[model samples]
Target chain A: MRNVKGPEIKSVEDLIGPLARVRPGRPGGEVSGTGARTLLASVTAEEPTGRTAGDVPVPAAVRRYGLRRLTLGAAAVVLAAGFVVGPSLLEDGSGGAASYANSAVAIEREGGDYVARIKDPFAEREEFGEAFAALGLKVGLNLSPASPGAVGEIFRVGTSGGGVGRGFVAGTEPSGCSPSEPGCVMVLRVPADFTGEAWIELGRQARPGEAYRNHGSAVGRYGELRGTDVDGRPVEEVLAEVRRRGLQVEFQRIIVGDGGSLSFEAVTAGEVGPAWTVWDAEAAMAGKVRLMVTPEKLDDNPMYEPGLGPGGLDDLGESDEPGKSGEPGRSGGG
Target chain B: MSDDRPARFEAVYREAYGRITAYAARRCDSPQDAADVVAETFAVAWRRVDELPKGQEAVLWLYGVARNVLANHRRGETLRRARSAGLDAEMADLYAAPADRGVEMSVIAEVFRNLSEDDRELLSLVAWEGLEREEIATMMGLSRNAVRIRLHRARRRFSRALAAAGVPFGMERRMVPAGRSL
Candidate 1:
């Protein structure tokens, strides 16, 4: 087997820095001392109640085994009834249960709206669809891999038939909960009586080798090149920094076509001269960077207008607008 | 054995608290969440102190617990078991500090974050936690070969994804020769 050690990329500690540098108290001393004492007290208090490690809920086994059907007896009945009565029963107010939960998802009817909390984001799409279908919803949930900032965000929605009035809204449970953070769940709220056939696509963690359908800029806050200014710099200077970081570099020659149309073409190292002007640099992948260059300096940076910075593009070829019905869109870094 | 549980827990807490706090801080978005994970992880450690491994291995055990706690927290299953105002304050201050953000850094972070959860965790165990392959295999309950294979696959996937995003070249597979054009 090949050695697992690869390039010397920045570690998470190097990227985020130490806790003491960011805070006042020592992490293990005063701060954790108080926390440890408090937690010990809480645990001691709970010990009288006979709560043990077994009492603490372990992560659901659903992740290990794929999606399991709704097993709650009452919830199962409600879902079974839904399959029999169909969607019309929900509007009649005769549906016995107003909520149902499985290992995969939990959906509740909140007045005129149906609130669904996605429990297993990696679960099969059919499982999500089944949960919605149980509530008599004609909604289809398609989860696609997205960049870090775009995960758990709804990127596209497409409706075909009737009854979509204003369509549905998709968001996180606690308003702006970061998907990577705790206590955050992806939420989809649809009007209870929506009769239209709708397809909703939400961003989920990408599988290995899967391409991210939704893209965020590699620059700016939380981006790879946060403070580096490569725009309008000499290729020689930028290449030196790239080499210094022990990172591989790739070059994209920016060609300005007629009518201000822009296109990028890959050029070999021999083709790109040291004096070529680099208009922009983007993180192409781990251990590698891509520099957008031109043989001569242009009047303005074609990648962005003045003062907009990284994600601010001045119409570089294709449209960058997001949430265009069926198309995957690019989102700015959060 | 039961009488010495408190002393053992204290020793482990004092030894591993800083690193555990850093671990949670790097992965969590908020200080409160990180605090909760740290507190809960130790609480579990206290409860199951018998299962806590000896000496340095204890920290690895706590990391495994913290990982599970974080997973539960992400699913919204972990109820707030231990909440300390002081710890929360400390975490808030830590988060308030400025990160080394840049366009390239953001892209790298995005690519890193975009990786599969398993891949991210495997890489983080090495990079963030600074664990060796044998240690990772022990913590993850896998054989050394399993760790080696998984880590290799994760690195390759990360490189491929970065290239697909237009960030060319895999560090392991595509090292550019010196004096060659970019």
Candidate 2:
């Protein structure tokens, strides 16, 4: 293939010559009649509920937190039993009203910012919004299901309107505090005078059939494949382990292209034979794992084949240790 | 500390509008589909403004988002949400414009279209968008070596297909190293 050089081929650009001629002119400027402005407005006006109608009722809290709306009787009963307490107001050092706390969240003034610590990640979304509303801010908080490594991490921060100074910052209280430890809490810091409408989405433990909005390696300590290295293992062995864990499995056939380049194609279970080797595993959803397999064993695990530091599982290092925090505002989801 | 998201997004939209529109126009089958992809891409950028990277990287990030949006559009998952008359008109004009379609170019276009979606995208990102390997890695969420390997394979497949079609390798020699086969 190397020595057979013909005169008809120049470059990929030449091959795409006239077909690349489609050039739509720029959309009108920021405020112009082009759909750009309208689209901007529509997206900016969107709330954090993942609904376009802007009127969907806030979803109920997940069952794991074991929390419910505190009715007058329920609140008094819980208080008497010493199982829970009502919201509390905390004053700053200067004796000013600077902080507020509820059963689900606590908002306090720290330096020039107000920090809201989530006490119950599974609390109803409305409870979070109400806390911010009480403090005269328009911030909305939604905690979505995520893999173990992403728990308590903020997935996205979106804001609109004006008067939002420095916007907001979301992180754990003790910096790298993991949700698995006591005294660890996910916190969001907002400017004291922030008056704009903002939407914040954080990660929480996923429920059955709830897809993870973000993920880490399945082989990490907290991952589903933890303590079980599936890499280079035969398909039957991995499938047995997956069934033992009561988890579903999917397969992606690894195709070695010319020059040893690799690509993957999703294949049905029947298409795979027990002799196929597993190259890597990914957290496909709450209770599912996707295995990358090949018909025969290769020279090296393609996941780490390119010598690019653990393939695409950069999260493995950060997510392996307990109580280790990930980078703030890590990019994931759409 | 000031809220400058709106301003920042506006600047990026202005700078990237044409390039992104052309990207959508190239992949989409119709003017409306192309317009919808453009609109949805920007809308997503606006919502995730804080995550949008700076300067040149921002365009690459937008391209990444546009790529996903295009995929969703192809799967019929994305609704025709952000349509406007102005965008529709612009896309229609772009698709309607005539091109210098020589017979050779036509044959090449057919062959290119016959390639898998992944191959077509990898090739176009190199030829049309003129993106480097690193930029493509960032845009596609792959390692640099992965992009290199995939690009090598895509090029080989394209050249072989061209050869099979009787299109001889022509005037300008590609910068393949002397002893390298592909």
The parts of candidate 2 lying over 4 Å away from their true place are: A1-9, A23-33, A45-334, B77-99, B171-182
The DockQ value obtained for model 1 is 0.06
Per-model fnat list: 0.06, 0.15
Best by DockQ: 2
**Local accuracy of candidate 1 as per-residue lDDT tens digits, B1-182:** 47777777778877887877877876777678888888887777666666666656677777777888888787673334244556766766765444645455456567888888898887766665666554665565553324544664566577667767766443232221111000
Candidate 1: where are CA atoms >4 Å away? A1-103, A134-138, A157-170, A191-199, A206-211, A234-296, A305-334, B1-182
Native-to-model Cα distance after best TM-score fit, residue B65 in candidate 1, in Å: 45
lDDT of 2 by residue, A85-128 (tens): 22665454564335677777888777667789999988988988
For candidate 2, give the docking quality class from DockQ: incorrect
Q: Quick one: how many clashes does candidate 1 have? A: 24
- Candidate 1: Cα lDDT at B131: 64
In candidate 1 chain B, where is summed lDDT lowest over 10 consecutive residues? B173-182
